[model samples]
Target: MAAAARLFRDAADPDSVKMADIAQAAGAGKGTVFRHFSDRTGLLKALVVEETRQLREQVLHGPPPLGPGAPAEERLPALLSALLDLKLNQRALMLALERAGAGSPYLNPTYDLWHSEVAGMLSGVHGDAAADYLAHALLAAVRGDLVEHLTGQGADPDELHEGLRRLCGSVLAHRADGTV
Candidate 1:
């Protein structure tokens, strides 16, 4: 699975990833590939689900500075940093998934899992409302738009961290009345 994932990641042309290529990368026969994944779409779906599961695990229970025990204020930035790293590192596979349209919808269980983890983290320090707000904020940040904008500007991960930190802090510290 990891070998297949690497092939997907390394494929220069997203449309060119082939079952025989994945089989070669996985050191398995074509029959073995069929036995395991059934088809290319099946393999892609498995990869997406596996990656989503791994990401959720990392965000929820993996080592900190980034995991659940960290303060929401701290964890939010770490989460964004991890997300940005994922975006940069896995750009090709992500693009393939988007093109294939074969995985879970954006609002599917993967997102619910993320929303719960982020909202839970935020709720720790800011209460339910603030947690919800931060959850949405983090979600918005993780989606491609903000990350793409930052990347287009040549902003490094550290720069993203600092900017997100300030944004979350400002939002969390103020009321609807515009008073600090």
Candidate 2:
């Protein structure tokens, strides 16, 4: 698994990754890789699931700013930032998984987790309806492809983070007239 991870991370093109490559990199037979992972998509999904578990742990039990100790205002942006980091790191694997599934990303359980969390936070600051819509919109803004596109066009990390901060603020803010 470690060898497969290294190969995936170092690959110039994720679409070119194959079970044979993973098997050779792991110093094992092709049958061994197949027996463990079934296929390329399965192997890539395993990698993503492993990475997601750590993020879940941080949100579920890790310290403040990201966990439970911070206010909603602080936590919402923090959560988005953490998610952006994850998407940034796993862009290749995620892209492979999406291609293999060839379905709506909304159907993915990870999207549900993020949507639920963001909606909950937004609900506290705004209303239920706006929260629901804004949560999905905000998640869209930080999508892997969008981030990749922005960076490829020369936007820096700080610029992206700042954009996220402003986005969260606008979504969470109430109108000056005391209305949504």
Candidate 3:
């Protein structure tokens, strides 16, 4: 079953993942694959949900410089860098799941939970609105095209970090009172 799961994940790509290909990769007969998954959609759904959960956990609680408690400038860069890595490493899995017509798993776990967690964190750095905006912008920035552009160019992570700092700093630098 684990092997089948891995095969299903690995078989997915930007375009599609055929059941036969997944079965071949798993070294399982098609009937066995169907027996376990019932259908391709089932496998894809499980894979995407599991993957999204893992990714969200990493972003929320994984480690310093990657998860919470880091300064916004630091957190922002780490978030973007980690996302880029995910895109590169899990390119096929992410793309395949995205093409499957599912909404973001991140949003589904309760938008208010994420919004408050992220927004609360941002409020510490900026105000509530700026934090909200920044969080939204960061999410947008990490999508397919941006990740492709950054990682495809072989851009250094530190450079990316500094660049984000400069950008955020320009817009978000503040007085001690924390107003813009």
Which number leads on lDDT?
2
Give the per-residue lDDT of model 1 (tens digit) for 54-97: 67787868887677677666776677667666766666565555
Which residue runs of candidate 1 sit more than 4 Å off their true CA positions?
27-35, 38-41, 49-55, 62-64, 102-109, 123-137, 144-153, 175-180
User: What lDDT does candidate 1 reach at residue 131?
Assistant: 74
* Candidate 1 global CA lDDT score: 0.69
Which candidate achieves the best TM-score against the true structure? Answer: 2
What's the TM-score of each model vs. the native?
Answer: 0.69, 0.84, 0.62
Clash count, one per candidate: 0, 0, 0
Model 3: per-residue Cα lDDT over 1-180, one tens digit each: 455446544653445457776788778889988888787656655665565566578667877675777776566556556665665566666555444554452444433344555565568667776778766675555455565568669976566556655665654466337566
Model 2 stretches astray by more than 4 angstroms = 103-105, 175-180
lDDT of candidate 2 over 69-119, digit per residue (tens): 777779889999888887677766655666676434566667788898888
How much does candidate 2 score in TM-score? 0.84
Query: lDDT of all the models against the reference?
Result: 0.69, 0.77, 0.60
Candidate 2 has an lDDT of 0.77
